[model samples]
Target: MLQTAVLQWPGRWTKKPRAAAPPQFRDSSQPASLTVKSPKLAVTLEPVQHEDFSSLVVSVATTRDRSAFARLFEHYAPRIKSFLLRQGTDPAQAEDLAQETMMSVWRKAAMFDPAKASAGTWIFTIARNLRIDAIRKARRPEFDPEDPAFVPDAEKPADEVINADQMGCMVREAMAELPDEQALVVRMSFFEDKPHAEIAEQLRLPLGTVKSRLRLAMRRIKEHLGDRA
Candidate 1:
């Protein structure tokens, strides 16, 4: 049996036999008979042309439209509940979390801005955030301040470290392949961190000549790097 309850402004708790289309929740102006489907879920989600769902939210915020809010709640509650259940939350807790998530939607409706995000996107984010908080609260680990191992290690992704090492190797190999004069200018400019003008003065080369050599070295490096597919 499927039952949906709207707490703030109550709606009839419709009941249906097993294997039925999802519940119907009508908006102030638009009634939703949404049919939402995914690999993990197959629920009723009537297709309504929402060229502008943001406007629907506006109706609720400005006019206190219960119907408008009801439509959003009915459509999303099951989806949110299912998502939480998939994450290993108990059935009772999942239902409660879904209700709380929709309740938050109603409370925070006035803050919704169409310019920033669509109604669906905004509501989904709210559900996700609430789910995270609920899970964390449910499974909070004990911590002791005096424990030496209590300090969490900062983790850099292995891929990022590997990429950095690869780039360094490429640069070294590229420099080794460069002519003596070009390599010297490249090294002083990049490795020694010397200014181009200073390098020109120290090497007794004109400024334009130094810049031209550095440009040539960069072009060679780019060529060595080759184009990605």
Candidate 2:
């Protein structure tokens, strides 16, 4: 099974005793909670160290803990597969990509830095890059230079060219003003011509989250343009 393959990975024979668990995180004297809100439910997890799943990654990195890696795989694999399916991948290919994504996670576990991103974000990034590579590979046919669609467009007047450059600069400035998460969704939905559902899946966010981010981004962009005008 792919799950078995993923957990066993390359260093299964290492017999190092599992290290003692890390100290618990706390809010003052109380255990800190991590809330994960999905479309189906909102669950508040008990304060385990690194409730964001960072500790599991650390364990995998430092101890070669198969159980920790297995837990991470179980959490991320389905999400990655669902994300690929929404990006128009066929079922079989999506499954393969998901497996590949997990394998990469296993190989690169030692490189994970929780200070930069959560475990989920890092894993999804790998999935996204692999998807892009697969898409590029599948588009290998050479361009037909003589095809009518390849005909050059009429030259634009100097004034029109200047106006387009100014507009593009303004758009870029507006995008730069956005928070990273909002800017990402905006690029996926508008710049890349992907739908909100696809954006949500790829980002491992809820549908409402994608829509709200788009709405907020548009409003902010409009405000920036208005100020410039």
Tens-place lDDT per residue, model 2, 1-229, is 1111110111111122122121122222353232222323211122223344777887888998899889988888987876665455677887999999989888888878775556766786688778767864643354576787896546866543433234434455666556655655664552232567755655567899879878998888767555332
Any idea how many clashes model 1 has?
8
Best prediction by TM-score? 2
lDDT of 1 by residue, 124-222 (tens): 778666765776554434577579878854574654333322443444456555654665566455322246886676566789987988898888776
How does each model score on lDDT? 0.58, 0.59
* Candidate 1 stretches greater than 4 Å from native: 1-52, 138-229
Q: Lowest summed-lDDT stretch of 10 residues in model 1? A: 5-14
lDDT of 2 at 100: 94
